[model samples]
Each structure stands twice: as C-alpha cells, then as structure tokens.
Target: MPNLSTTYLGVPLKSPLVVAASSISSHVDRVQMAESAGAGALVIRSLFEEQIQLDSMQLDEFLAAGSDSFSEATSFFPKIEHGGSKEHLMWVEKTRKAVSMPIFASLNAVSPGAWVTYAKQLARTGVNGLEVNLYSVPTDMGKSGSDIEKALYEVIESIKAEVALPVAVKLSPYYTSPANVIKQLEQHGAGAVVLFNRFLQPDIDPDTETLVNEMVLSNPAELRVPLRWAALLYGRTRLDLAVNTGVHTGRDAIKALLAGATVVQVASTLLQNGIPYLSTMLLDIQNWMDERGYKSLDDFRGKVSQKHCDDPFAFERAQYVKLLSSIH
Candidate 1:
C-alpha cells in the first residue's frame, strides 16, 4: 500500500478524500461511517444565517402565542433565550467528540457581524477548522463584482479577527478573476480555499407553471472547472487548494491531486451511492499509486499541473483553440 497521508489547512489527514458538508453530517452514524470508511476530514453541514433567524422567529411566536390570554400566561414559560446556532454548536461539539478524524465546522452567513459572531461560537466547539461557505446569489443590479468581493474579504477579516481556528473559504465560481481573489483571501488570513461552491439553481416546471426548488446532485462532468483552476493555481499561491463541486470517483480525486489540490471534498458521490463508497475511492487511489510505484501522494501531486507539466497550454485557451481547429 502507498502512503495517502496529507495535511489540509495545517491538519494531518490519513487520506486526501474529505467528506464535504451536506445532510450526511446530520446523522451521527453516517459521520462515523465516513470516518471508518477512510475520509480525511468531514465538514459538517453549514449553520445558515437563515436557519438562525427562522429559529429565533419561531421561538418568539411560541412565547407570545397565549401571553395575552392572562397575566400569568406570560410567566408560565421560562425566560430562556435560544438561538438556532446553539443547537448547531452542540451538534458540532458532539460530532467532534464522536470521531477522531478532523471535524470541520461550516458556516454560511451574509453579514459580517453574523459571520464573526457565529465563527467565534463555532471555534469554541473544538473542531479542527472552519469552512466559511461563501454562498450567495447576487441579485443586486447596483452591486459591482468588486463590491461583492470586498464584502467577502470584510467578512473573512472579521471572522479571522474573532476566531483563531484555521479558516477555509468555500468560494463561488462566478468571480471574474479567481486567481486574484484567492491571493487576496490568502492575504486576508485564509488558510485554504475550496474551489467552486456548487449553486443550486431553481428550475421552472413548465407543465405546472411553478418554480421547483428540488435538489440536484453534481455529476462527474462538473470536475473540469475546479480541476483547471487547481492546475492554474498549484504553484502560484501559498493557500491550500481543496477541489470541490464535481469529484465523484478515485480517478476524479487523482485528477485533483495531479492538479495540485491539497484535498478533494466529496458529497454527491457518497450521497448518491453510499457512505461506504468512500473506502472504494480510497482503495482505487492506493491501487493506482502502487501500480505506478508512487510511494506517497506528494510523488505524483502537481506532476501534471501547469507549473510542471510538459504541455502547459493544455490548461490555457490555446488548447481549446487547437481542439476546435482539429475538428476538420
């Protein structure tokens, strides 16, 4: 067997295949299964700002439901203040205790205050690191791309100021200049960046004339974007690159490593197939390494990236032009 141990966000992992944040973490058994199946790390599902707000609203409604019926009705309930984040925090702490593998907490928030506040709370959960899920759809026509990027930096800066844990930013792929953005994130104290947060776009049901907000899992074909970015950024920046969004198999993970990704975060494959499938993916990587006489992941990592590859232009537009020209 070959060595698969690697470090991600300064934390040592037994394998490079990490389990991405998803509903899989909602179940403690599934999380433990992932750890047993050879996942490098597990990012717990995000504590979304909306969830917190909704929880608070529900609590208020419960407290005021029959308060006006009588003076003692208000006193019938205890004056305990509750927030959804607290439940999520307890869950994270519990998950951290249940597994020995690195447990990463994820947060998705809009405002800088929310980011910093919850980031501080999550940091106290004894998790190995934090993954800031920067997931948002820009609906403001007046907001420039620079404006959005600035907000992201401000949120990250605020969180870094309040939290001491290693922070990894899960970035959206819609940025005009991704390399510069990753460089700026590193400058702002991000330890790693998960390439390309998959956006769940809503679809319209033509027959029913209704908008359908269904869950659509990612396919293997979605790996190209992050693979290209990883190859382009391999030797250019100090930030650890975690290729996300489309990794589905061991070959996909190998491609990510070849492109210099520090780790590959997977969620769709496990959800679609099964959690135990993680072991299969890891086995495939180990077998491939053994057959090639590669002793460790570092031996082949980034070997085909743009920085060291024989055909550098394969990752550039020249290759696309060549492919188009070769059509006849």
Candidate 2:
C-alpha cells in the first residue's frame, strides 16, 4: 500500500483526508465514525460569535421579562448565569475526548477582541489546533479591500498572540488578490490556509416576494477553483494548503495533492453520501497510487502544479484562451 501519511500545520495525519468543519461534527458518534472511516483529522463545527451574542441577548430578555412583574418574582430566576460559549466549549472538549485523531476547533468572529477571546477559550478545549473562519459578505460600500485585509491581519495577529495552538485561516475566495492576502496571513503567523471558504448565498422567491435561505451542498465541479489556486500557490509560500469545497471522491483528493495541497478537507461529500464513504475515497487513492507505482504522496505531489507542470500556464489565462479557441 502507498504511504498516505502527511502533515498539516505541523500535526501528523495518517491520511490526507480531513473532515471539514460542518454539521457533520455535531454528533460525537459521527466524529468517531469518521476516524474509523479513515479521516486524518476533523475540524469541529465553528463557534460563531454572532450565535453566542444572540443566545446571550435572548437569555437577558427572558431573565428581565418577569423580573419587574413582582418583588418576589425578581429573584425567581435563581441567579442563573448565561452559558455563553460554555456549551460549545464543552462540546468541543467532549468531541476531542471521543476520538484519538486530531480534533481542531473552529471559530468565526467579527471583531478582533472576540477573535482573541474565543481563540483563547477554544485553545483550552484540548483540541490539537484551531481553524479560524474568515467568513463575511462585505456590504459596506465605504470599506475598501485593503481595509478588509487589514482587519483580517489584525484578527490573525491577535489570535496568534493569545493562543498557543496552531492556527489555520479559512479564507474567502473573493479577495482582490488572494495570494497577497495569503502571504500576509503567513507573515502574521498563520500555520496553514484553507484555499476557499464556501459562502451560503440567499435566494429569492419571486412569486412570494420573499427571501429564502437554504443549505446547498457542494458538488465535484466546485473543485476547480481551489485546484487552480492550489497549483498557483504550490511553491509560493511556506504555509500549508488545505483544499476544501467540491472534493467528492478519491480522485478529487489526489488532484488536490498533485496541485501541492498538504491535505484535502471534505464535508459535503460525506454528508451527501455517508460517513463510511471516507474509507472508500481513501481506498480509491490507494489503488490509484499502487497502479501508478507511486509509493508515497510526495512522490507525485505538486507534479502537476504550475511550478512543475509541463505547461507552465495551464492554470493561467493562456489556458483559458486556448480552451475558448478550441471551442470554436
């Protein structure tokens, strides 16, 4: 069997297939199943700052609603303390204890202070690492791309200063210059970078004139974006690259590795198929490697990247032009 072992953010993984942060990690049994199914590591569902804030607000409202009803009822609440992120912290720690594989906690926050505070708390959850989700849709017209990048750097710097765990930044693909932003992240102490963060876009019900929000899982076709970026960034930086979104099978994972990704994080495929499907993907990779006579991932990893590929512009616009010309 070909050696599938690889490392990410300095943490060794038996395989390169990582479970991306999603609802899949909500169940402890599923997490253990992922480990059994051959996942290298798992990133727990993110602890959103907005969710914590909303919970705190709801609790405050409930506590104050009946406080003014009567003097005796003022203490009726029993001085209960708001859980805040206590439940999420406990969940992360519980999941960590349930499996022997590396468990990485994810955090999504809006402010620098919140990022640092939550990162510190998550670092105490016995997780092997942290994945910071920089997910946001910029609606403010006044904010320039540089401003957004600056805020990201500040948050990264703050979290790195406050926490001891390795940090992986899950970046938004909409950046003006993703490579430049990635370089900045490296300078600010990010150990790794997830190629792209999938954003959920709301749809409109034209007949009812209402907004509809639904979860749409990724498909294999979505792999191209990260694939190109991974190939482009292979030899450009020292940061580990994790290709996420659109990886559905063993060949997809191999494609990522060939493009120089340190590992491939999958969630949609597992959710759409089944947890056991992870082992199938790994088996597919192993079979393909054996057939190709590749003993280890490094044997051909980055072999097709822009830095090493025969066609240096394969991931560039020249290829795009060639494809269009060929279409005619």
Model 1, position 147, has a per-residue lDDT of: 94
- Candidate 1 structure quality by residue, lDDT tens digits, 1-328: 8999999999999999999999999999999999999999999999999988988888888778768777798878778586568889999999999999999999998767888889999999999999999889999999999999999999888888888899999999889999999999999999999998999999999999999999999999999999999999999999999999889999999999999999999999999999999999999999999999999999999998999989888888848777888997
- For 1-328, candidate 2 gives per-residue lDDT tens digits of 8999999999999999999999999999999999999999999999999999999898888778877677777666688877989999999999999999999999999867889999999999999999999899999999999998999999999888889899999999898799999999999999999988998999999999999999999999999999999999999999999999999999999999999999999999999899999999999999999999999999988988999989897788847776788974
User: Which RMSD values do the candidates have, in order?
Assistant: 1.6, 1.2
Candidate 2 positional error at 304, Å: 0.7
Q: Which ten residues in a row have the lowest lDDT in candidate 2?
A: 68-77
Best by TM-score: 2
Candidate 1, residue 1: how far the Cα is off, in Å: 1.2
Query: Judged by lDDT against the true structure, how good is candidate 2?
Result: 0.94
List where candidate 2 sits over 4 angstroms from the true fold.
68-71
lDDT of 1: 0.93
